[model samples]
Target: MPHDLNRLFPLRPARVHEVCGPSAMSFAAIASARAQGDFLWIREGWQPDTLNPVALSEMADPARLLIARTANQIESLAVAEEALRDGAIPLVVIEVTRPLDLREGRRLQLAAKNGQTTGLCLIPEGMGSNAAETRWHAAPLFDPGGADSTLMRWEIIKNKTGTLGFWDVRWNAAAHRLDVVSPAGE
Candidate 1:
């Protein structure tokens, strides 16, 4: 079950989470679905058209989404930091092109801790150093079956614990949940 899967790697309330790789957006949607309440999405200059209201409506409630558009990564992070302070927003997703060093990363972590919000950074490959408690790599897999659900792969590249692994997850749109299709995709 999704609940059982979540227990293995639940998102910490006061921590920075990173979703990266070729298909970071897909992973962000999956992570967002697991969140409890409304969220704030901060889009850097790199992704202006990625925030489609119609598409978001399918994955999440468009009305509950609060968007902050910034000209640069610094500005986007600033907006995210402030939004993270609001405890009402359980999740804050930030899209950035560049990597974040430890110092700046610490600030984000602290803000999340103070507001008890979950911070998720959606970035592309070669992000260099990341201070997130957990780092994930997401990609889509070819599903010849053409199943109703989307078949995706998730790799826990880095985490607080020493646990490292990957899995094949199915995005069941009808149920609005992620199910473990295969462990390790072996």
Candidate 2:
């Protein structure tokens, strides 16, 4: 079995991990379970917050989730960079509608790595190029079994050290664990 997110896809602490596709938010919430500690969500203030508190409560400690608003991508990234370096927060999820330059991207990785924290960068559709250690393109798929479970269909667009594969993500609220279900067709 894959030991860490790196093996699962291309996620690692101290590296910029990009998540895209139609269900990026859902993917982000599910992926966040892999990382522990306080959560940091950085996004534009203008955008509506679609995070479901009850659903998140089933995954991580909902009380630790913090949402920060920024005026632009630069500030959001800058805040993310600083937060990653603190080492206090374990997971920093940045919602970006724009692309980051190489230097800024590198800084995010370095900061996260130096602080031993996980950095999850969520990029919306048509916002920017997928750039990171691993880029996950995901969309929600109706459960074939007609259960209440949510199946997150995803493809590893860019995987540096992991094999390319597709899987359906199912979150078990009771167990609070993420299970990779049968691989779905593209």
Candidate 3:
């Protein structure tokens, strides 16, 4: 019986861990999930105008992405927890203003593992614990066009999967995709 259960439900790979810095971390996460398929996006204080409509449209077709906006952080987390329990979505990405504590994060992690889903918690700069598979610190990067423009660069601070760190990525808000950029001098 145990062998049958194991065969029916093989263990999943460890979720990717990453720490984002000062760039389009949210967009990057969304884009990545969209490419993979079957993911839910729980946005807190998300502004539609801030996202690139074309990019969002491309990846979110045919029910590839689901967006559920919440009134506050607690509501967002609660909704995420519920979704994880339902086991309907394969990935859940949440945007939060404050980092979750170790205990709460562990609970969420367990739920994700049990549900065979990936839980990505997006928080403000310096708003997460070591408990998360990957803790990302994201901020908007400078846009040569103008301060109001949406082009951004993101940095990856910590990656639990391996020693991968400090990635500078470019985001096209219009396309809602991430690209690797050359160094400043290059």
RMSD of each: 2.8, 2.8, 8.8
Q: lDDT scores for all predictions? A: 0.77, 0.76, 0.56
The positional error of residue 34 in candidate 2, measured at the CA in angstroms, is 2.6
TM-score of 2: 0.87
TM-score of 3: 0.65
- Residue-level lDDT of model 3, residues 1-186, one tens digit each, is 111212111112224233445443454444454445567777776545344545555435535667788888788878888876667776677766677777777777777767667676666666666767655455655656446444444444554543433333454545755455443553
TM-score of each: 0.88, 0.87, 0.65
Model 2 lDDT per residue over 1-186, tens place: 233333664256667788889888877777677666678999888887678889787777778888889998888988998899988988889998777777777888788888888788888664444347778889888776768867887877777766666677777888877777765445
Q: Which run of 10 residues does model 3 get worst, by summed lDDT?
A: 1-10
- Alpha-carbon deviation at 32 in model 2, angstroms: 2.2
- In candidate 1 the C-alpha lDDT for residue 170 amounts to 81
Model 2: CA > 4 A from native: 1-6, 126-131, 184-186
Better of 1 and 2 by TM-score: 1
Question: 47 in model 1: Cα distance from truth in Å?
Answer: 2.9
The candidates, ranked best first by lDDT, are: 1, 2, 3
Which parts of model 3 are misplaced by more than 4 Å?
Answer: 1-22, 33-35, 44-55, 58-62, 138-152, 170-179
